[model samples]
Target: MSKPPLIPFSTTLFVRDTCLCLHVQRAARALARRFDEALRPLDITNGQFSLLMSLNRPEPPSMSAVASLLAMDRTTLTAALKPLERRGLLETFVDAQDRRLRRLRLTETGERLLAEAVPIWKQTHAAIDAHLGEAASDRLRAELLALT
Candidate 1:
């Protein structure tokens, strides 16, 4: 009798079995692409949108605070703020009480941009909810947030 054929562990099998990371990454990319396309007229990326939203709270936040909120390190956050700062969307100033600290503020331009972007963001958000259905999407978002 012939021996039974053995299955080899190929890259494809490995990827298929352990590809949740890839699937999540691809989904994030797709979602970002959709948001980018939708926000193009406003000239904002999703990251920027998030940053702007973070700064839209009642009080101005410190650099470290904003970085913590965004789950980004100080260096990465600094780099990300460059374009927004250059565009007059945000400004960083030395803290009055703590000279060593830098505070992030949304300029008038930033506020205006965010106001314009809100409707675009709403449309993208609505489309996603519509595609996934409200309950499922909400539950998925809750799960994802929990993981984060």
Candidate 2:
């Protein structure tokens, strides 16, 4: 086949500079790195911290609810839960009222670890907010929520 027409270099530059999805992904990865580093002393990834925090509730939440809140599929959430479960940080059990539903809860160990992690998370978040300025940080959160 004949060679296809090449996309112009300027078009590539335009997309690189202006693509919202690309920018968001880059920012997310950077933020994840920052949080991961901050949480590393606790032997937890940023994702795990978020997962554990979600499980802190008066009643255990259904697996589907946690998955939805985390924007993860069931299988991915299940895989993510395995490490925490193995560590005895959280547990998954069949719902008492609904045998078909599985629910998740943080164990006492998980709760304590999460409690410790909160200060670290808060410190990191405060630094980030300060860097962004409180108003800008709030606006960015609002914009991100709107996108979601």
Candidate 3:
């Protein structure tokens, strides 16, 4: 089979400089890495911490609801839940009224873990905000939310 032509270096530079998605994704990965390193002592990743925090609501949320809130698909959310569930950090049970529906709740352990993660999150977030400057940080957050 014939080989396909490679993209030009100029195209790479253009995408690197101008692609919003690329920039956002790169920033997201770096931010996630920072959080992951900080949370390593707790044996959790940034995504896991976020997942657990989302379950901190007053009532257990259905799988679909949690998935929607996390901006994750059902399969991805379910996969993410596995380790936490195995650790007894959360539980999933069939809904009483709807057997086909499953709901998620943070266990006592999960709550405790989340409580521990809160201060760490606060510290890291504070550093980030400070680095970006208070006004810039707030503005950046507002702009990102607008995108969503």
Clash counts for all predictions: 0, 0, 0
Candidate whose TM-score is highest: 2
Each model's lDDT comes to 0.93, 0.96, 0.94
Sort all candidates by lDDT, best to worst: 2, 3, 1
Candidate 1 deviant stretches above 4 angstroms: 1-11
TM-score for candidate 1: 0.90
Residue-by-residue lDDT tens digits, candidate 1, 1-148: 9775586558678997789788788889999999999999998999999999999989899999999999999999999999999999999999999899999999999999999999999989999999999999899889878888
- Encode model 2's per-residue lDDT on 1-148: one tens digit a residue: 9775598788999999999999999999999999999999999999999999999989999999999999999999999999999999999999888899999999989999999999999999999999999999999999999998
**Which 10-residue window of candidate 1 scores lowest in summed lDDT?**
3-12
Model 1 RMSD, rounded to 1 decimal: 3.7
* lDDT of residue 7 for candidate 2: 88
Model 2 lDDT vs. the true structure? 0.96
Rate residue 67 of model 1 by lDDT: 97
